[model samples]
Target: MTTPARQPAEQQPAGPPRPAGRLVLAGAPLGRATDASTGLAQALATAPVIAAEDTRRLHRLAADLGVDVPGRVLSFFEGNEQARVPQLISALQDGQDVLVVTDAGMPSVSDPGYRLVAAAIEAGLVVTALPGPSAVTTAIAVSGLPVDRFCFEGFLPRKPGSRRRLLAELAGERRTMVFFESPHRIAESLADLAQALGPDRPAALCRELTKTYEQVVRGSLAELRDWAAGEVRGEITLVVAGQPAGSAQVEAAELAELVSVREQAGQGRKEAIAEVAATAGVAKRLVFDAVVAAKRGG
Candidate 1:
């Protein structure tokens, strides 16, 4: 981005020096430029410093809004956020309001801005935000799932083993889950989600949210996996149904079968029952009773 020369103090009319300026974490438009909040234009015209993830996009947004950014623009992406927070905090300490904006959505969300926000807070500086379009809430609103209670899991790990492990950890989570995925890995992620959560678990795959070519695919995880087999593109957001209440437990007979396999693998009967209880989400006493009944040929 083109950096403008700093305005000299004497260039402006004399006025009382301002107090410590606030750190504003503003949400940039996710897609259409018009989606920017009303305060955005005012902030652009007045903020003394603007830290943008992509200065080009920031400039484009300013042009679309028909406003001038009288602030000093700095590249504040993930690559340089750590190195740039000190500069931003220094500006805040000098009574210059610093505005933070990402390429899209809110800053500090799966994007850069957390480090700076944290630094500002630790330094006892005022920090605020401008609420606007967010892909996370946007996806949930259209997910067709219970939105009253939900959790955002951010982006799943790239490694297959790590991804599966994370999914397994969430298998019994009762609240709806939201995730962001890359187009290239959506297919594999959906497939893994189906296996770890359940093929019949309801889910929605939201793509290019709030943009032209926006599409939402809602179905069971298994169905989504099949659909993702074809060429898919654009940014992706996934919302998955939570496990049903008391639905994770297995039947005593199935629990007995699992315990039997564990015993055959050289585990003691008591230890096998305990292991099955934890793994199958069943009570240990239930497996013990099933095993005893099987021994009596009942």
Candidate 2:
């Protein structure tokens, strides 16, 4: 038989090599595995490499969802996330799809995927996300607070002083605020929030979200602080109502009224005047003058 002419390498129709690898940040269930989306399950099942914030928790999640993660699992947490960036990037460069997941919620929102994602972007790799349950959004949705415009504050500083300073800075933030807190410190945090943001500020404490013991408590910051004082458990998310528009334009009369209210609530005259001045974004002298004028008028 006549030998067929071999196709030149240049003329070979091998098709385009599959486009370079992808990095997918998948959101895990906040509490219930049943809340996981189909895309998340498929990613867990098929990705060649899986980087998890908690490997053991990832496995437990897989078991809960009855999905098998057949890929090589790597621990990608806060401690080692930076070290693992190069390895994960190498995998993506080698055209292997990799999935990055946290123990709960989407990766990189107060999670470990930020370093990897930023590294991938700098390295010119394809990076995408598989949206799933988020405690931030879930808490806001159930918070009954104004969500038309909001900001996620994530976790506040753990130390009381730092936390208070941060809260004071945000006291005048007009956008609705969302925060995450550990169960142990929720009460103290709430109390500090009440003190810094004002006791009558509308807020909600969403605890153990999307779980059997889920609770959403909505009230003034003071009430929530008192409620949080007794045996609060599970993951907690706090949503605080934003300062009203033009709240900074408080009239002297309004400031005086606030001082009176605080005084009625057992705050000393000086303490109440100072509190009103701070909250109303006015000067202490102005508040003191207002209180004095009101006292003379009464």
Candidate 3:
């Protein structure tokens, strides 16, 4: 025999096996289709199981993006999200990647998919996200208010009384507040906000963001309320300025006088006290004590 056969070419070792499955929460565009991310396109094209808030909307989005969704599509909306969680989790356990998307914006911010994400995490499944557009952040970014700190207050209660109570509770919140409202209730909600947070509170009304009729109106709550009273349309997001800094340090005498003035202006004792405390950014109890002490001295 001539020479030994040349040694076979060395081969690289295989990498570690990936987990069986993963849950990916992809954010859709708030309004415009072009805002969708490339990761969304890739996930739409490759994910084995796609759970969408609306399968029809998902298909429409895919068409707009010129991407073909070759995977199985399933409905994952509020109406059926609870029931579909188990099935989606099972797919993840089988090592299949599942993509969760909503009709607009992120899947869990004022949308469905939170339950599925929690369940997936509980089941030891890998959960990730593809960042894209979000109505909350978009509204806040364009609000022209202090964005250093903010809070998202999804949608207010549908019932007026419940909504008013909730607003009253948050009247003293020191962080910029963002709220989502329906076209029909935007006016009423703004009016309630004006009453709860005071008419002079600065706010912005962002409507139909990233869409054809996009508009952002910056003004006091009273001004926004008046504007909302007219023929307002499209998805609405309200951004409210937080209480002024140092307001919580008002002197006890001044706080008492403010409470007295509110009482004289027709507010009930408790209501006046609460309103004063909120406006002053002080504890309600402090206001209450000041009011009590003032009454005793009188």
The true-versus-predicted C-alpha distance at residue 29 of model 1, in Å, is 1.3
Using TM-score, give the best candidate's number: 1
Question: What lDDT is obtained when candidate 3 is compared to the true structure?
Answer: 0.88
Q: Give lDDT for model 1.
A: 0.88
Q: Find the 10 residues in a row with the least total lDDT in model 2.
A: 244-253
Every model's TM-score:
0.82, 0.79, 0.81
For residues 181-271, write the lDDT of model 1, one tens digit per residue: 9999999999989987789999999999989999999999999999999999999999999988767444445667887898889999889
The TM-score measured for candidate 1 stands at 0.82
Task: Report residue 211 deviation for candidate 2 (angstroms).
Answer: 0.6
Q: Write the per-residue lDDT of candidate 2 for residues 13-119, one digit (tens) a residue.
A: 67776667899999999889999999998889999999998899999988888899899999999999889999999999888999999989999998889888899
- In model 3, what lDDT does residue 231 have? 91
Worst 10 residues of 3 by lDDT: 244-253
Error of 1 at 285 (Å): 18
Positional deviation of 231 in candidate 1, in angstroms?
1.4
> Could you give candidate 3's per-residue lDDT for residues 95-117 as a string of tens digits?
89999999999888899989998
Q: Count the backbone clashes (under 3 Å) in each candidate.
A: 0, 0, 1
